[model samples]
Target: MKKYLFYVLSFFTLFVYAQDRQLSLAADVWPPFTDIDGEKSILSDLVQEALGRMKINSTIETMEFAKIFIEINSGRFDGSPALWISDEREKYYFFSKPYFYNQLILVGKKGSDVSAASFDELSGKKIGVINNYAYGDFDKNQEVEVVSDLSNQKNLENLLSDKIDYMLVDALLIQYMLTYQLNDVTEFLAIGKKPLLVKSSHLALGKHVQNAKIILEHFDEKIKEMIADESYNRILELNWIKADVDGDGKMELVLGGNKAGTSAPQNIYGLMHDNSYKEKNPPQRYYVDGKLYETWDNIPNNYKLDLVVDSTPSIEDTYIRLDFLD
Candidate 1:
């Protein structure tokens, strides 16, 4: 009886020690998704909570997107929340089951009539692309006008100004840009009926990390459980659902009123014209002193305004602040 008791105690002690092991995560500010605003990623939060329920602790470190990938490859971090599973990457990383899917799209100006029936048709056109981004087969042997900075607003500006014929960008990111930054001057038309590339994103474990394969297997099982129990869907709904900020059942905010200042008066007023609120809404809003502020700079850098609202508010306002990192 004493031997059995000792065995049970040893098992419990090992379990406790395992539970206390911290899982290090590397992430970047990929908006409406992963960001480093005090445990603010919806996917990250869900994963963290799930880990907690499984008796694992995790600490996320936010860094540049490029650096995050580099660190993960070099085993400086244990894993990253979302990364594409590619052949080149497979050599250095073990991937969990895909938790989300995304598409790479070709975005052109609204009125541009430059649709190509096939990939072969874009042979000579100056194609703007983020440096080192894998567009699957679409990127193979294609001549591209590479933009080293993928998230820079200037790349879109160049596309709008006709410096480049078309730019390859993430579909969701293009939608966000149209809703917020490039609404006035730029619009995106799909270059082809099919996506330029379709890819799945997974939690990637570094190759050099000890027991990486085993860790990835555990992560895979957890993800499967989350999906089977419908927890994954709940997380998606929490992050992706369009929110109506103006109480219109639509997601738009109309700002054209008497209070709009003269310098940028027409710009704000134009938002309300022709019932634009019926269309898509902004993913987030910036407000100060009960009045909605338009631009990022409008909010005093020091005061830290009243509210920074999201399409879906996951964490408390004090814990997270939203800004266009790109």
Candidate 2:
């Protein structure tokens, strides 16, 4: 009886430990994705939700960008939800499927006479870029004088002040900042039509972690399920939905509010407009979503709610309603 009791107790303890197991994660402050203080991070939310579905818990720690790679490789943290997979990192990490696509573009002031379809065309010019950012073609270019900064805002400020002839930044970051952080700065900046760099991002688990392969497999399954169920879109809380809102069998780009991941303007359905001024005042206006609402107070209780994913439309072609233009 004594031996049986001991075995039962041991089994119970093992079960409890398995139930309480958690994955420790770390990432850098990539805004519109992860935050510095680890608050309201969209990527964090998606990762946590996916892990939770697998009955696995996680804790994310925000750290310096460069340090995240080194520490995770050294087994300091379990993994990162968002990382660009590379040859060096592949040796020490198990990477999940691409969850995010990052497009790096060049931005210059309006009518500055700096036109280039490729980075090579801008040789001998001074360009500002985020320090530690892995820009494939833009990095290690001896022809261009590369100015390093820690953030996009700093680079934009440098561009505005003529400290740099051009600036490089993630396309999504630029749009998010224009909508939420730097509304006034939008008028003076013009994003290049062509992207300088494009890469897919993934969740990387340190090779040192036990059962990392199985964990990554489960993560991939859960994340894909989230997208199918539309839970992934909710986690992003973006301003636009790519679905066909007009029932015309083609997807029409929709805009939501002043910012993504925030409440839309009260009783307003944001509609996209033509690029009348190019970079200056890319047109956006508020209209009624379901029922025509001229005032916020008159919005109907039965109006349908529309949600958007984190997909940007191509500048060359997009469906827009001219009647909705303000």
lDDT of 2 at 263: 39
Model 2 lDDT tens row, 1-326:
99789657654553454386788899876665776442456677888888888777788888888888778877778898888777777887899876656666688876764457666788888889877765655645679888988776677778887899998766665555554435344457677754566666777888888767667766777775654445655576544433333334332324333223233433211111111112333213222333223333344433334444434533311211001101
Task: Identify the candidate with maximal lDDT.
Answer: 2
What's the distance in Å from true for residue 279, model 2? Answer: 23
Count of residue pairs whose backbone atoms collide, per candidate: 2, 2
**C-alpha lDDT score of every prediction, in listed order:** 0.53, 0.61
Candidate 1 error regions (>4 Å): 1-17, 38-43, 73-75, 114-118, 137-139, 174-193, 238-326
TM-score for all predictions? 0.59, 0.65
Q: Candidate 1: minimum summed lDDT over ten consecutive residues — where?
A: 264-273
lDDT score, candidate 2, position 98: 63
TM-score, candidate 2, is 0.65
